[model samples]
Target: MRLLLKKKSVVLAVLLLVGGLYLINHSDFLMAGLSRSPEIHPSELTWQGQLLVSKESWVDRGQYLPLNVSYQLLAGAPATEQRYLSIGISSVNRKKGSYLISTLQSIFSMSSSEERSSMVVVVLLADFDTGWRMATLKDIKTTFALELEQGQLVVIHVPLEFYPPITGLKRNYNDAPERVTFRSKQNLDYAFLIHYCAGLGQYYLQLEDDISCAKNFLSSIRNRVAEQEKQKVTWATLEFSVLGYIGKLYKSGHLPLLARFLFLFYQEMPCDWLLTHFKLVMTQKATILFKPSLFQHMGTFSSFQGRHNKLKDKDFDDGFYTNPVAEVFSNISTYQKNFPNLAWDAGEAFFWGLSPVKGSYLTVVFKEPAVVTWIFVETGSGTKDLLQSAQVELGHDVVTTGKDKSCKDFQSVGAIENGKFEMQEVDKKYSSASKCLRILVTATQKHWVIIRKIRVTTKQSAPRQE
Candidate 1:
């Protein structure tokens, strides 16, 4: 009887120990896996006041910050008891549409102040397919107006179509559900949004329905903008598309004149595409903030222009020059004939190519005599090879130089073990008072390539003659 009792006690103790271990492991999995929670070090955290400077504190170039600034957290506790901004999402879907929202929520939940100040996820509706979209939209205004805790700013996402009519503006919807046609109406919408946001906050972020903010997107944008602003970049476009070769334009040194003519004569092309190309030619760098106002001003839908097609009589109209491709080519040809040394790549037909001016994110600083640098990150071993094979040339005459130009050859600096090749000081020369530099990379034995990132840095003075 004593032996039997001892056996029973041993079995019970073992069962209890196993159960405790299982619970501990499960708890860790929940916190690390399902929650996707960011780790917070309580000891390392500190609070800082919001940073704001006067417009005059920066330069007066065309650069200006948005008018709305604030954010909120729909979930999670205040990691630190610091005053910060708030951004809220008014809708969430649980069905197929929810995938994006869920992903967004996950990203927001994991975001850090080092990335974004603060963010909130207001689940206005659980299922968007259940006819709750309209109701969700309607409630955003009241939710936004709700006073936040002290020391916090609130930024609301208010749908523009639901708002009341503003006096003195006429709305046109000729391009409904397909294209953006009414320039005045689009501008008016932006004006109203800006004005409304101005009353509520210091900076406004107007995101489109399709855009998915990356975890570090806000932080990246803020840091990039702050750096550019410090350098006094008046006009910045993030994404740049190649128009064509610009050697012809560089030869004539008449890019500004040609661009002016193209802008005036060709008003019908896609503004975003055209502006991006222009940035590539002039600044050799393209950057623009992804915001509703910018979209309204630039985004247009035209099924007639899908991918690349040769210019034809059928495609020509009063807006022929307005088309991004047509306008870009026209400008490229004109600039090429005049400048001749500006080489550009329009990208291949299959590839959408790089945007000279359009950026998924961007910032602008109102300053003068700024410096800019363009950095391109090559991804994939084959892509790096291709980049290495291509030669870059910088010259004053676009029409006269080709692959044989003295400043066209690129030398390999080093190869990254991760399949990337580094090239530095490929071609540098001083002509007149302007400095010219070019970098070219091409694949020696591979096809199909990917670029990781392209960085452009602009500086004002010549490094103090050091």
Candidate 2:
């Protein structure tokens, strides 16, 4: 009887030991579940539930501090898998209006289908208003259903408890108390957003909720990054726009460093200022700005109540110039190297010409006729050097005289007003394909003329069916 009792006790002890080992081995996987609360370590941020923070987020700040903040995945799954790029945008409820929806629309609309596939856009709804956050999420889901389904867009929110005390911050810049509080909170918002996006991709891009994207902006950014990589240029930040915190790109591996810097001095300065400081500390002495900015600010009202912001990027190009094969001829005296062809070329430089009198003309004759669909022309970067008055004309039937080619007849399409002219889906007045497009000056002006941009879209007529 004593030997049978001993065997039973030994078997029960062995079974208990095996169960303990199994639970210990799988504890991390179980605790990291989306539904379960995660175990917190004072020195490290746990990858819990929908929060996909990676283990590499451990930063070596002089002293270790616990980050008790947590994020709620409001929409779309976090991109745990690596992507080519990750875009981070933080939005708050504005007093006057909201630009988040428009910003999202512009990003997806401007990016190509393939470009969208290689990147992830993470939107942090950093608003404290629960109702507003819910409404915004619904709007985004409804408007961007396709993008969300394709895993290109992910939306998230931080509960109020996640933020440290925002009020009663030190006024380092001698700013107003409300302004100080606003900037301080903004700092924390960006820090949390940066940290969250650190592990989503190979690179990260920082954008705002109130901006418009240029056409094929993603491709332009990728090309620039590739150029830098090929040249072996060690850079910390690549700027695509000059506007505050608009189009900044960083490497994913370096994001933890950036997030730590932002977290350490979040209360001392605004996010933009901190960005400059961060760049300096990283040993990047010069600001690398890509010309013909890929993004532009579209919001007039500030996120902070009652303050109006009307900033615009002067170098932003909408990628309109799609002129068909043609030869450009202009009678206006060229300014230095700013030739007539430079205006139509797919580049940032524009054509600068001396002051023009009435009847001065610039003409583009296509090698083959096309069904012209769209034409856009912009003059002068500033008010002083504008083409005061001009008329846009479409020419039909080409004729050769001497060594020069000319249009047989020209019909008025539209006139340049306020130094700008744009027409899409032009009414085809002629029955046949058009031969040329022209700009004829109607009024003389004292200031030099700057043909800043000329864009045309054309489609050939379908082959006639026999």
Best by TM-score: 2
Against the reference, the lDDT scores of all candidates come to 0.29, 0.79
TM-score of 1: 0.27
Cα lDDT tens digits for candidate 1, 276-311: 565566564545433211111111211123323232
Model 2: CA > 4 A from native: 1-49, 55-66, 320-466
Pairs of residues at least 3 apart in sequence or in different chains that clash in candidate 2: 34-49
The C-alpha RMSD of each candidate to the native structure, in angstroms, is 24.8, 12.8
Q: Per-residue lDDT for 1-466 in model 2, tens only?
A: 9999999999999999999999999886544422344333323222333545545544523324434456766677765587888999999998877777767866876677899998999998887776787678777886678888888998876766556678888888798889988888888888888878877888899999988777788888889999989988668999999999999999886776787678788788889889999889888888999998989887768999847997999988755323567888888999999998777876678889999999998888887787665577889987768899999998877777665566878989999999988664463343347788889999888789999878765555432232
Highest-scoring model, lDDT: 2
Query: What are the clash counts of all predictions, listed in order?
Result: 84, 1
After TM-score superposition, the amount by which residue 57's alpha carbon in candidate 2 deviates from its true location, in angstroms, is 6.2
